[model samples]
Target: MHSVDKWIEIAKECKYLPENDLKRLCDMVCELLLEESNVQPVSTPVTVCGDIHGQFYDLMELFRTGGQMPDTNYIFMGDFVDRGYYSLETFTLLLTLKAKWPDKIVLLRGNHESRQITQIYGFYDECQTKYGNANAWRYCCKVFDLLTVAAIIDECILCVHGGLSPDLKTIDQIRTIERAQEIPHKGAFCDILYSNPEEVDTWAEFPGEDGFWGAPKVVFQFVHINGLKLICRAHQLVHEGFKYMFDEKLVTIWSAPNYCYRCGNIATVIDFKDADNREAKLFKAVPDNERVIPSRTTTPYFL
Candidate 1:
């Protein structure tokens, strides 16, 4: 709770998705990144986050479960809006931290950052109700532009919202993406933002559909990829709120507990404290009644 009050005060005035313009998000984010990109990267302690679908209170649970900020820089792997309730509350909290301590928080971009996705989920509507559609659209673009696609900490670990696509041969290529589109089209860029878990239970490779062609191959190719010990992401929903996919090389962190429509599963995260002590801990933050094994209706809400 470092300056939680001041943070909230700033959040009160923070923008929402409805107020944003989808076309200009990345430019704004790049500009902001340039301002603090000079901040020395540190491994003092880092929390690798998954996806948070508007569960702001659950984010508080994460802050309580993993530990607080300033002491440990937070890396949010996107989806700060849509689904659940309180998109504004959730984005405001994270935005406030970014505004207050730019050096301590690294927020990555997720597929849901786009206006198209938010419209289907809850954020777009929430914004209209709270800030009106016009404001929501404007804030949406600004927030999207502010998101980071990937973050390299001391060049040891690489993190993003989605896993590697088959065509992506290296990490450097990920950095060069202009990342300025309002939304991704079907291509290399779309593949990056829209990738899913590489599991038969979750995804079937579309041999020719091509989008999922190179995904499942990421783990086997890990040794060839340089400067990456692990790839962390959060896109697909986990029954437990977080699923460690791709034979552990890729980890999915869902910071949103009891995800969309209250499925009643708990979310989790990974913390790297030192070289040999990188740990994955799962905690149930959802209430017991809802935390039961989700029924067959437990489909991923990403659609």
Candidate 2:
């Protein structure tokens, strides 16, 4: 069986929807799959990245820090365009890279990818704010919809833009993201958007109220649930550019240096491959103590 077939089989087993529904859903997802096929065709020895929030210069630094693209298959966990000054340039550069090395880049959808979020957090708003928003909206939205929900490499590591959610009953649950849903609501879509890693979720009451869901058990559950070693995700600024959670069941990486209105903390990513037998480690693009920007802003991301 081919890789895609194996993915579908696993997704079918862990399906929340019935088989008939699964087929229908997959039929819709089929087009997305085809488009993605030409988008990032390679997937080994991949370097997984975290959030890149429109800091165009920093992103260039990141590529330097992380090393050249496609040489090591690239997986960007999400948050490619937002919160900084150069979303247009950043997104265009990434898209160009994707087009050139269609076989090497893995792009995941983040909270910012949704239309609503983009209207607020994407380059659309930034363009409007910075460039008067004339014709940017049309092209930016087109690129936004093309982003994928998640990417799994070698069935050993899973990657997503945000934290895990209670709605995810199994690993295959994420591996099989429908990727065909409309945005701007707090449904399964919101869960993906708001998902965050927190210890409280592990020992929380049923129907947890944090709204988004995640826990160490879920990591193990999903790992055992899917037979993968580690899940790598990007979202949540790690002062150190990356963080390890759930006894290392999940690793949170941030490729955006000086996240969230330029706090000045750098970023990091991990490179893994079959040659090294799927081993993973954290690589930093910048450092934490370096956040000495000499000014402070009251703007908050969590709120």
Candidate 3:
């Protein structure tokens, strides 16, 4: 087995790992993820981040802002791949860190982690372009299948890629989901990964999407019934980096700053000092002069 530390250095430099080494890294991460629960429990002093959509440089900036792994525990809520220029390097770096320090890093599945979504978005093509085949992508998808769906920080704050599910009222119900396959079309599993927060009176269908919009009343009820103090999620892009709804009962943290490299929006992460006391650390996109931009290609969202 290759040293994860060395792989981390290569990934940070925007270099692709050899296909065999990448496969080994994926297998190592899969073993670690399989031991995690569907709703993993995390301790305090952990930083909660939102979508990372393959902004590799920005992710490096995030580590600088939030502090590095092992020393600073982190729980990434998902959307690790797609939409950016370095999905391969980005995902591989996270996988390497997880393999090296499983206790310090927590990766949760996002709506975009699915095979169908990646194929539609950008990860699939990026993999093809980088490695000249889909083998690396397949290996990464296997790791995605093993990722936990949600995480509970100190057993009080619920962290998920999307909002709550109508079919599942409690966190325990979320734990019962069999999440080792491709995301489903419509069900609790799909809802947990695709839903968004809204101002409706109750659970309402999200127009033009496969998920639902969780109403404030419904969200408050869910948190109260489950004895949760807060729900942190990321799916929508908030120009200010993060947004709180339902009187702070739920929060949306967007970590992909200057989204798509043109949205001109900032990014933020939640630094949980202890579970109750937390601070929002905001950051901007890495300056162009500081990093090398890869050759341009047509991204799905732009096309």
Per model, how many backbone clashes are there? 21, 2, 0
Q: Pick the candidate with the highest TM-score.
A: 3
Per-residue lDDT over 247-278 for candidate 1, one digit per residue giving the tens place of the 0 to 100 score: 65666777676676456677788887854467
Weakest lDDT window of 10 consecutive positions for candidate 1:
17-26
lDDT of 3 by residue, 1-303 (tens): 458888988887878899999999999999999899999999999999999998999999999999988899999999999988888889999998998999999999999998998998899999998899999999999999999999999999999999888898888899899999999999999998899988888888877665998899889889999999999999889999999999999999999998988999999999999878999999999999987787665644532
Instruction: Report lDDT per candidate.
Output: 0.63, 0.60, 0.91
RMSD of every prediction: 6.1, 11.4, 1.3
Off by over 4 Å in 1: 1-31, 34-44, 199-210, 213-216, 286-303
Worst 10 residues of 3 by lDDT: 294-303
* Distance from true location, Cα of 239 in model 2, Å: 0.8
Sort the predicted structures by TM-score, highest score first: 3, 1, 2
Worst 10 residues of 2 by lDDT: 11-20
